[model samples]
Target: MILKRLIFALLIIFSFTSCTSDDDASTPDRRSIEDLETDFQALNLQQGINDVTLENLNGSSWNFRVIIPESASSTERPLVLTLHGAAGGDVDAHKNTACYAEPGFAALDPIIVSPNGGTQLWNSAFNQDLVIGLMYLTQKYLNVDRDRTVVTGYSNGGNGSWFYAEIYPEIFTASIPMASSYSTFSSNGSVRTIETPLYVIHGENDELFPLAETQEWVAATRDAGTNVTLEVAPGLTHYESCNYSPYLQNAASWLQDEVWD
Candidate 1:
């Protein structure tokens, strides 16, 4: 009878051990923030543009340019995710002319990332997911100041900026959308109130997306209680993308002094 009791006790112990093992197998280990920062520092990324190709969360490949500032190692800097226009080829060239690369934006000492949108429009669900995944991955490896993150883009990329800021208000603090139309995302001429501030830059004589319509939409959005600012370039056209740099500098200044401050 003692042996029978011993066997029953062994069976119970075995069942308990099996259950513990099963629970352990189901739970995944999460690394601490300090550990993640240590891993990022270990990479020893150089100051300047680093061409990186990372696998997206969806198992697809994404090519992007990361511009690390000189003070990145010592200080936690703001992150700027700049998207290129629809004519997306050679992300490096796009980065060269974009406003974030200009001297004014550089003075902010922020880490800038320019991602290749490929042939697809940035407003599409697939590409939007890719943007979110990329931003998260960037945060995982870089010392990013979450409160000062900005999303800015041009033309089709501007459309993406608006869409992303609207959809993921918790991620971005401010948005600068240049040469874009609000009607692209909000077809019914309605603007959803979002917490992220918007600084829109558009050419006064935009041939493709009418400036008048954009002005109307901006007015309506302001009336709807969104913190928005619009800058109209006097004589610029939609295709003269390079000329928008000066305007972008103003937007960057506004972001640094007014919005982020």
Candidate 2:
């Protein structure tokens, strides 16, 4: 029995020593420039889109999906921001996106940001920190091409498209807000003064939002000194964005054509 107790005591001492050795030292996360550069080179961003989260002013968190195209290079690549509606959250809309989602993005590569609406509302109020939080989070990871930033959204997301674009016209090149309408002004309630390109799409048969909204958005943008294009899909309903099927395809193509410009 004595020998057994001694053996157990020895085992306990050895275990404690091993654990203490590990606890005695902690490594800092700081890395040298050369080390970081080496790590960056070893990293592969070609794994398609990724998931990211950010904290909001309300102490809540938001999720987003990022898609990077194979054609995208380290150079200034255009970034696409796709917003979701109130009923569906970020994940749902991210999956529904024609190109950034499944079989669509499996081939074509474009940087897409699908963010979760905190309250499912666009929160156009300049007081809200959502836009600033987004800009910070975006700059933190991916190298977004600011000069070519584009915003698009459906339903409530459409509000966000207009809110973000109008607020930061200098940061965005074009905006496509589908099936929705805004007051046609920047965040500060000032009329749009810059010349950001815009493409508006709406279904004439839309019941949730009148098809006339498409025309209204275009008119407002043009009147505000912004270049605008309008497309009204016939026989389409508000909830059913079937018309946007081709619209999304063209959106990708059109953006691709101008990414370099």
Candidate 3:
């Protein structure tokens, strides 16, 4: 009887293991980039917003937000790359706050590309690679005007705008940095080498990044012969400076009339 019981227990265990293996085999695998591309092709990409995930050569991935206006189907529109602050790891928040969010990047009528920073700061080799890859993808797939590409961001994102503008000035036409100062670049006049115009916006009463530092940096950059415009919002703080969708339209207009001139 004992021998019979042992054989029955072994049979039950083997049956359970086989069932588990079958279950594992039945589960579907994750979709590949090809699958995603196929899905994207089916969408009406000329209107509304799309949240995209793209894989890089290093097998890493990028999650970004793309805003395609109604004009994208017929017109080669300008592209604005908006970076995010230290708040989050994804582009969701930045997508909601960038020039493409609610007011519609209005008069600018540009395609907005906002990417996740992946880190708290923006000065990294991984981020640089990601930006280059993203730019390539945008140029190849989207109706992006390469000559009029703009880079803008707030806080930490603003720091990225300044850093990338200095490093890759050839790709960008102008930069709008809000409540940010030179992060990796110092006052050694290195920013003077930038050919792209800069519009520096800040709050007068910011406690995190004081307006005084920004003033000094802008003064130094200007002294270095870099074309720059400074706009200060009176009685505003570092946190308050992010309310920009309403005011950025004017800034975009200025870029069209002044900087791109």
Candidate 4:
């Protein structure tokens, strides 16, 4: 009789422990925003570009560049994850390709991070998880305004912006994808309803990805109740990457005034 009673008690304890573990897994991080800001201030990071390498959850090392504005302080500032194009360049070259490290973006007073796309494109599962891990690491070391975090990219990176917004809506407040297409998600049948607002910028005369296709995708996404806007640049080509900076700056302004505000 005592053996049976002991077995029953063990089962009850195991059930309660399992329930507790499940609930704890679903609970949100209990750290306050102030605590995060304090931790960032402790870093004493200088105002300029810094090269950083962090290990992802999969034990792979990822290289990225961070641009800290002069105005950064203990107060939480907006974070912009600027993905680079898949042009087979190093992180330094990629950061400059899309004007992400330019003065224009710095004027917005947001901490910009540009990550190098590894052997695969940003839409790949490995790269996607790497991006997520980068964000988490950034949050750990920087005073990021979680409500105003943004994801923006150019060309291949632009496709990634859309992918992250669609797959991780809860992490980003908005996305700005420039000179990109919907091929990645559409081809994989991964298109779904996205709540994060999107500001898409594509050249009207884009030679690689047709402008019409982006318009069609935007229309479909809008019809599905997504807060999305498409801005077409006239006489702009795919290779005119630097020229897109002004348009991206405009989009950033819109995000500030419309979404973050």
Candidate 5:
């Protein structure tokens, strides 16, 4: 049953995810393509993304994707900011199946934002205020739960994934980093001891970085007595392993639908 489930999840991650881009479609979908362009212009409460111009502290103009949720009510939903891998700075990929966060996160409709690294690396690597700018924007435009904010990513973004979680543990309720090593504070591990909840995923058969790197990352948080969860996929490579839908399903299940009281 586990094997069958893994196969089904792999299929969804590869093909069955709900998001797609013109660059992703099997063929040129003129009608849906045109509709998408038109829809981007017409924004409703159903939630959409907005392009923002931001200048990092180092004077680099950072491109940002501010993803809103579907027609939500009562109060605004939580806010989650996603980072991308070194080669995958484009936000559209995150909005699509790869990151499993789109215009709509099914469980909880939070304000999701994805920031493009100015130079194939996070602003932190550039000694800038990009992340702080993100915090400012989150506070400025939305009424966040404060304790419910989340940071998640994979690979290069996975490095940034733990960066935010470590630096600002007070802001994030939970963090998930898939298929990336976690030592962000230089040669030493300073922020590894925060008490925030974390969900980590990786493949035992991953060839990118040894399983030890991921295990070390988790050990930091665990040694600090934080609420951390880790999952090791079997018989999968690094890229496709983290891309599996079941891993995303597990992540979404842990992250969404939490009451911030």
Candidate 6:
């Protein structure tokens, strides 16, 4: 009888161990994409600058900044992703100071997102994927109005804006690229016909990116059934074109007319 009891106890122990092992194996290794997307929707974001890091689907991470206006609400608001020049600058320079101080844009009270492209031009496939992922996160978590999402950038960022708008035509409501022009990045049917109206802002006297290239690219995009408009600053240089507050306001107004109207 004692021997029989010992054997039965060993059998029970082995069965339990096997079942536990199987249960552990059945558990998921990672969160679903849908769940991950909405995971931060309830995040408590404060007004002003909030530096944060987000993980993209490909297991890569992005360090970006978000600027929330003081008058921000829980209701849906417009979201603008501003790309910096080749300088790899921070968000405070782009959002709180330059953009918020602008007239029309300040009144619009949109949430501004500026990403760190890490000292490189915004030309990487990883950056491209991160940008799209950032937009998805912002719209889902930050109360962004999906229909009013816009993109604008200066110099390198400007090139990024044009490139992204072409590749992901359905992602944005409008695109404004300052002191930049189209390149092989957006050419050769690499990007679909831009569904969003694109406003190309360049300095006629720009020495870095030639004005001739800007006009030619704009014309080609127009020929490809894209509703594009080019605005040239008469005497402004590439740097001045980005800092000219009035022109930034004008771009904001044009975006408002296109989507908010």
lDDT of 6 by residue, 17-121 (tens): 234345565665533355445544534678877777655443445677787876567667777888877754453434433542334367578888887776556
What does candidate 1's lDDT look like per residue over 159-189, in tens digits? 8888878867777889999999875226665
Candidate 6 global lDDT: 0.68
Identify the superior model by lDDT, candidate 4 or candidate 5.
4
User: Candidate 5: where is the Cα deviation over 4 Å?
Assistant: 1-46, 55-59, 72-74, 87-99, 123-128, 184-192, 256-261
The window of 10 residues in a row where model 3 has the poorest summed lDDT is 1-10
On TM-score, the leading prediction is 1
User: What TM-score does structure 2 among the candidates reach?
Assistant: 0.66
lDDT of 6 at 22: 54
In terms of TM-score, how similar is model 6 to the real structure?
A: 0.75
What lDDT does model 3 reach?
0.69
Pairs of residues at least 3 apart in sequence or in different chains that clash in candidate 5: 46-70
**Segments of candidate 4 deviating more than 4 angstroms:** 1-45, 87-91, 97-101, 183-191
List, residue by residue over 65-133, the lDDT tens digit for candidate 2: 666665665554556677776644435454556532333223235477676664546753321234444
Q: Is candidate 2 or candidate 6 better by TM-score?
A: 6
- Candidate 4 lDDT tens digits, 73-169: 6578788988887657564644573354364455568888788886678876566655665576566567677778899888888899998898777
Which number leads on lDDT? 1
Model 5 over residues 160-251: C-alpha lDDT tens digits?
77666776565566777777776523466473465567778787877987887778767765776767788886776777733445675667
Of 2 and 3, the candidate ahead on TM-score is 3
lDDT of 2 at 141: 49
For model 6, which pairs clash? none
TM-score of each: 0.78, 0.66, 0.77, 0.77, 0.68, 0.75
- RMSD values, in order shown: 12.9, 16.0, 15.4, 11.2, 14.6, 14.0
- Cα error, residue 194 of model 1, in Å, equals 2.7
lDDT of 4: 0.72
Writing each residue's lDDT as its tens digit, candidate 3 over 1-261 gives 322332343334334323434556566554443544454455445476788776543345667778888898899988888887774565465555443334535687888888887755775656665565566557657887777888888888888888878877766778888879674344663545456788888888889999888888887777777888888877878776446555566678777898765
Model 4: how far residue 261 lies from native, Å: 1.0
